[model samples]
Target: MPTPTPSPDELLVFTGSYTPDTGGNGAGLAAVRFAPKTGSLTDEPRVSPVPVSGASFLAAHPSLDVIYSTNESDTGAVSAVVRQDEEVLSPLGAPVSSGGANPCHLTVHPDGHWLLTANYGSDTMPGSVAVHRLDTDGRICELTDVAVHEGTGPVAGRQESSHAHQVLVTPDGRFVLATDLGADAVFTYRLDTGTGRLQRIAVNRTRPGSGPRHLAFAPDGAYAWSADELSSTLTCHRYDPDTGTLAEVSRVPATTVPDVANQPGGIVASPCGRFVWVTNRGADTVAAFRVTGTSLQPIGEVPSGGIWPRGLALVAGHLLVANQHSGTLAVLRVLPTGALSRPAPAAHVPSVVCTLAL
Candidate 1:
């Protein structure tokens, strides 16, 4: 049977942000209704106005109405909320320590039993991935385990220690992958469901000082890509689900804007698998790439419509951008050939870091 189409306002997208307490201008968790047909937002409101300090990133439960977020701060934490439809969200439980400082990303395990986070450690601590168990009622539970990484890259200040920027579960749900920006490597782990623990299985190193930050899998699940934050490049990997390994294959420049220094922010593969879109923070542009099997071809670049395009997500044939510095939400058309339309504000949101489409 064919799946029924979603209505214009049926898609509930939430914005994770940085509040004034974190030196950012966001008030709290906000919600907006996105209209896919016109690539615009219908209305902007504080649907879930809970004050989660530095809620910089968000993820949804795979099979529940719960939402998870990373409180990105010096003393990092994570929280859960029960999303009651589009307008109301109630706290599922109190926020808990993330076992490390400055957690920037998280993902719900495929089995719905675990929530994994990547803690970007502070000056004194090392970055690590923490595992937490969730209750059947979707409540965020206590920390069960943490795997701290060690080693550093060549970059003096930025690479002084391990900083796990993002944690992700493989498409096959067999292995967990983490992009450590300070270590210049992607670490793979296996989660023991019964014990709620993470075991390090593999470490795929990128270019010596690449500073790998985020990982996006190809739609086909045959390849993976990483936004090399420090080196301003994209590294391709051949993903092996059986052995749970990512073998580095190729590299490409992440920025097309001329002369300006660049740091790639968000990187996501299009749902169709033929394209990849990335945001260039310094250049404030979106770079497009055509994926042909194992290699990616540079297509073109488009302005992100606001300053500091920190993150992006592709939904309903559009690229939703959270322009952190400009305090705005921008929408861009994702063309068939892997290009994007001009950046236009769908809403003005302060200190927005990411947009999670539900």
Candidate 2:
């Protein structure tokens, strides 16, 4: 039989893993093509021998020619690679240190001129957020500026310092938002497109003890949603799109606490703008929400049927979940009602897989 070719609109996922060291996570990469029908998948194309040890997170540029990875380690760094022609390519040069430890996530500016990273590390020393400019060749140029987060969250014991977990620029590219798990707040910053600089706007605090992680914006960009990893809840904020101000509107529990505490890592809105999905590490499941304007109501929760749900991506119509502990990837059918079912194209991976694509 001939190898299945991907659809014109089909998205291919690139993920990293840790399979070699039994004591350590595996070191491998994977490529899976998504199918639009019934939201299923065909097969996983093995692409391994990645340079990074623990490739935890990934970001694809808006322009779609380059991709980046966060090599999660105590010695944190970001690598930029291109997908030139039809091949998966390597970084144009060496990786750039994020100026902090365990750089967990990276995001590109909507203008495609700069790249930003969040460092999740220690309490006292905390972590820092750094900015990097991109060259004409789609490579990261220089480390522009770095900001060290100060102060602790409301939690007496846990929030002893700041851990910047995620950084994202608004859809409009006017402001940038960074979430601090230890600080329990989303720090808003103004982006300078030409100079590649970040200026502090305002630090919006979440409910006490709610360790904010990943964030998603509504399709119309009128509302913003944040997932609290420590608290297992989703907070809705009324956003002034022009001014970029966020006012907390409501806070709803995501499947109740103890079962969902380590939840809210990969939070993303479906491309159709009808549903939102968030991955729970503790529950090993993905929570589905119905999106009505800015209001979000929990509709259903589906088991990923794996050890831990780490990363999530929607390609064509299929929902892909990265199973960190089980050393495999799970594909699910996404219903029009925003529910998930039917697992297929499941395969064993090396370590914790973090998938991103063009």
Which candidate's TM-score is highest?
1
lDDT of 2 by residue, 75-146 (tens): 777888776544355666788887788888898887777889998875436867889998876698888888
Q: What is the C-alpha lDDT of each candidate?
A: 0.87, 0.74
lDDT of 1 by residue, 194-267 (tens): 99999899898788889998989997788999999999998899998888888889989998677988899999
Query: Model 1, stretches more than 4 Å misplaced?
Result: 1-10, 46-48
List of clashing residue pairs for candidate 1: none
Clash totals in order: 0, 8
- Candidate 2 residues lying further than 4 Å off, grouped into runs, are 1-10, 18-24, 38-49, 154-157, 256-262
